[model samples]
Target: MKLKCVAIDDEPLALELVAKFISQTAFLELVSTFENAIEALSFLNQEEVHLVFLDIQMPDLSGMELARILDGKQGKFKPRIIFTTAYNHFAIEGYKVEALDYLLKPFSYEEFFKSATKAFQFFEEKENHLSANIASPSEYIFLKVEYQLIKILLKDIQVIEAYKDYVKVHLQGKTSPILSLTSLKNMEEMLPNDRFMRVHRSFIIGLDHIDAVVRNTVHIGDTVITVSENYKESFMDFLNKWIA
Candidate 1:
């Protein structure tokens, strides 16, 4: 499928370059273009975009600020951002926010394709792996419940939250309460990495059930789970892969 995208740059030339590059790519669709972040935001709200070609310097709002604002929203629907900037100094900050890729100003189409290729590969690999995992799940697993063994479907679990000796099992049915258990490691071992990730020591979330993530908190509907610094890398990988 062609990746849906939008380009945002206050500089008309920069916007034109990105637009041209996107037009040249058969796998990418240039859904919209804007001279300002606000217009871009409005376009985004009205349509679904897989990726955004964003410039760091803009009059009303910087691309970094727009990324932060987008990340702050609810649900599992945050768009993957690719930052394009004149300054090389923002690379660190761009990556800090888990940007898909960074493009330097006056970059070649080859370089742009290189970054876009990485994003495409990352998403393709994730989808293939998730599809495989979902199709061939571990047949059954037992959750140790103090004195009894509770059997559950691997697909039915939304995620797990840990507290001291107890781990909460968020399941897939309507109005299902969290199942309490004492072993986080044991539960984690039973789950497949393609389907689950430990985003924090306190929370092991299902990749499928993650609705959205903002800042340090991950959202699954009305619930919010804190993301720890220690697990950020794994969490980001999961976010990219899972969201893909």
Candidate 2:
């Protein structure tokens, strides 16, 4: 299905670049472009735009405010959002709004294409799994380790444990000692409830990766993750399947 897309940025150059990028993509259609947030919100109320390319720093109304207006009960369709900004400072806030991808400004075609492709894939995958209960996806993330920005698949992470300033990421076959910028609280929000459980405040364990769950610990492969008493009640409640 061809996705209906729109770009909203104050800068003409940024809008032009985004429009060019969208025009080249086979599965996307450029619906409209807007410099003001209020106009975009008005259009959103009437049209079925599948994806929106948004800019963060704007006058009068910021992209954050615009997103809030478009979200929840305000609109019938929830378009997947792709945030583009020059400043990297708002990444945490952008993810909090459940933005599919974040594009840093002054982006090269390669960088723009990469984020765009991710947005496309996220839309398609989200469409495919609309009926299935799943984890909050990990398509967007920052890892200070390898310097390669990490966009982990949520289901791939078997266990996550907080280190002093970093987090040890254990996936299906690979385990990474990642220098994480996000606190465990922020990480907790990014993980979906259906596939993950907070055994410990510092430990977010993937349920499918769990080998066993004893009283004191949860086992994922060879790693033994401890369960704190505070989180135990909620964890056990998560384990109860809603069988009809």
Candidate 3:
């Protein structure tokens, strides 16, 4: 995937050079160029930019200030920053904000390419890791309860119930359910659909652990869970496969 990029530098010549370098690069797509950091920030807020070539020192708003603001932002709009400046004094400050790379002023195309390659590889590795997680379903998952990450086997999970802001994981042979600080939706995603099904908005149950299904309710170890109207059809489909 191409890294959608934007160059922000107060110097007209510097901006033009960066824009030219971006145009020449195959993996980097130059979205727009801005001589003002404020305008760049506005554009970044509205668009999905993957990487940014930002100058550290500017008039109204500095690159460091902009980087900090972007860092504080939550969600997917957080773009990886690459500090481009003539001064070497800001190198320490640039890395403090977790910038991808620091490029000094009057950098040659070789230097620019090297920095851009770092961004490219960073994004490439990230995409591969996400793809791997989606393609390969794990047999177990980890849950954070308090300070520790507790490993829970998928087959051992009997029921997952939504409790306030947390989800209670009821495991087989366990007297008490493990309470985790996460939504039921997140729990659903972590579980394999073929083995676990959401019979209600508040509950996900393991199919193998179920004892019986009576009408709209599911029985597992004397605990009855009512199947919500929204999920009853899918639950019925699962039951029909075993009816013979």
Candidate 4:
């Protein structure tokens, strides 16, 4: 899905550069550009935009103030914001408004792309109405990433690894795992109990995908996951069933 976005910067050159970068990116669609924050606010009130590339310091109304105003509103929908600023001091303030990322002035296209990718993921998750926990069961699960819904077959899943707040879903025949904004515990509850099992706090493996179990480790695909003591009793019970 293409994320509709607007660029707000007092500097004409910076605004143009961001517009060009947005145009070059396949998932972003530039809706408008504003030199004044007040005008941008007015336009936002009259239109629906999924994301905004906003400049922190602007005439009439500063981006910080504008962001505060938007955040104060109690609503189900709000645009994902990415702040562009010359000052690094406002980074913490940007977080208060829940900005997706901060792009310092003199940033290259590579930097812009990285921030834009994050914004895209946010919009994808928001639009899909996805939460940290799965609410239902199905044959396929939807993962929001890079402004797209990646459909992964449940049967194809081999392993799941917890990375901070995100989970990496390793699939059969795929070298790279799919990453999504969710916790390992949340995923453990969502997956079918008969098909999947949690062997460690940070790891969940498909029961059918386990190739071998050696000592305290379980092998699936090319990866090895340790069976923690907390879950070892149940894991051993299952392992004993197959050991004729």
> Whose lDDT is greatest here?
3
Instruction: Return the lDDT, model 2, position 102.
Output: 84
Cα displacement (Å) at residue 193, model 4: 27
Could you give candidate 3's per-residue lDDT for residues 94-131 as a string of tens digits? 65566888999989999999999988977776676557
TM-score for each predicted model, relative to the true structure = 0.57, 0.56, 0.57, 0.55
Candidate 2 or 1, higher TM-score? 1
For candidate 2, write residues 49-165 as lDDT tens digits. Answer: 988999989998889888766654343468878888999998877665667778887887788777777767666665555434345443444443321245567768787788754
Off by over 4 Å in 1: 138-244
Candidate 1 accuracy as TM-score: 0.57
lDDT string, candidate 4, 1-244, tens digits: 9999999999999999999999999999999999999998898888888889999988889999999887665566677788989999998677666677899999999999999988777676654645533565467667644334577788999999998757899989988888876678868877888889999989999999999999999988678999999999999988998685
Q: In angstroms, what RMSD does candidate 2 have relative to the true structure?
A: 7.1
Per-residue lDDT tens digits of candidate 1, residues 118-153? Answer: 667656654565566688855446554432345567
Instruction: Give the candidate order by descending lDDT.
Output: 3, 4, 1, 2
TM-score of structure candidate 3: 0.57
Candidate 3 residue runs with Cα over 4 Å from true position: 137-244
lDDT of each candidate versus the true structure = 0.78, 0.76, 0.88, 0.85
lDDT of 3 at 128: 62
* Model 3 poorest 10 in a row by lDDT: 142-151
Q: After superposition, how far is residue 34 of candidate 2 from its true place, in Å?
A: 0.2
